[model samples]
Target: MTAPLHWKLVIDTTDAQTLADFWAAALGYEVEDQSRLIAQLLSSGDLPEAAVTEHDGRRAFRGLAAVRHPEDPYDAFTGIGAGRRLLFQDVPEPKTVKNRLHIDVHAEPDGRDDLVARLETLGATRLREVNQGPAGHWWVMLDPEGNEFCVA
Candidate 1:
């Protein structure tokens, strides 16, 4: 057990910042702030202006954005999370098929309906409700960019 390796789930999207914002709100996480790092790279000519964009009034890499658990440890200089995190990166192609892996959001007991509604308000589209006798109940949903996830 070579000390568990650190990892993050990377998602591809046409708009990384927008997806990151949606996920941050949905998961009660915080968006990583890399404005200071971006500024330093830009000033050093290591980063091109076209590769940056404004997100929440702060400079961000145009092709990348991420969200992490609010209490997770992160590198202050780069704003990169060292714990549970999700990185959204821009991709040229659109999602063409179902996801082989998806996130499952488990709500508090008896709070599934409310959670589903809240997620919808945040841009998730409910595809269908599923109820398997004794197996449990859940809602299959799609994120803003059509990524599949479930709420239970």
Candidate 2:
């Protein structure tokens, strides 16, 4: 028998909190809070002081933040998530090249042009317009943090 898949996408970021906020606003998801994990790590002294940080005046784990689909299942206390989600994990370096794998959003009603406008308002900028003869039209757009996605 074929195996059932289990998955979520993780994106690397220098600032997890900021990236989480940006992605949540853009995708209409809520940020996952991992305060308990932070607390446990801090109290046990397993985490170094340098690995914890204050962002906007609140203590946060320096490495990660996540956003999940509103209707999707998540553990109430820890926010371990299931369903459409993007996890942003902090890294010291910046993203240096184009994404090898990216998302393509299909337009529901009036089509690609209309979807492009909505995405623009959400801080995605158009990269290029591609016309696929019989297949359809698409726009290559970049998210606020420069990750690419297609509107088609």
Candidate 3:
């Protein structure tokens, strides 16, 4: 039998909440909140008080947050599985180099340039422009965090 295919992508970040917020707003997705589980555990005495951590002047459950396409399916209770999703996991160190894999977004006919401009307004910077064989063109850009993505 073939294994089930999963459709989620993950990124490492020093601040998962910040990344979650940026991506949620940029992609029109909602941030996943696991605090309900954390709170339930705390109230049921199943989790230690130390399990929760403060982040960015807000209380975070510690470790992970994600954003997903609004129309994509995901479990509301667990916020797990089945979506075009971006997950940000907390790490002690910051990203120091270019990403080996990144995302590219395609826009509607005649809408790419406008999309690029809008993205720039949102803190993405154009890195370069390229024109290839037979009328193909694209712009390489970097996100606020320096991750690269192409607009075409």
Number of colliding residue pairs in each model: 0, 0, 0
Write model 3 residue lDDT over 33-138, tens digit each, in one string. 5666767778899888886776555455667777888888878766654678898887787778888998888878999899888888778899999889678888
Model 1 residue 111 CA deviation in Å: 0.5
Top model by TM-score, which number?
1
Question: Of 1 and 3, which scores higher on TM-score?
Answer: 1
Worst 10 residues of 1 by lDDT: 1-10
Q: Which portions of model 3 show Cα errors greater than 4 Å?
A: 1-3, 46-59, 133-135
* Residue ranges of candidate 2 with Cα displaced over 4 Å: 54-58
lDDT of 1: 0.96
Candidate 3, position 34, lDDT = 61
* TM-score, one value per model: 0.98, 0.81, 0.80
Better of 1 and 2 by TM-score: 1
- Candidate 1: the clashing residue pairs are none
Residue 116, model 1, lDDT: 97
Best by lDDT: 1
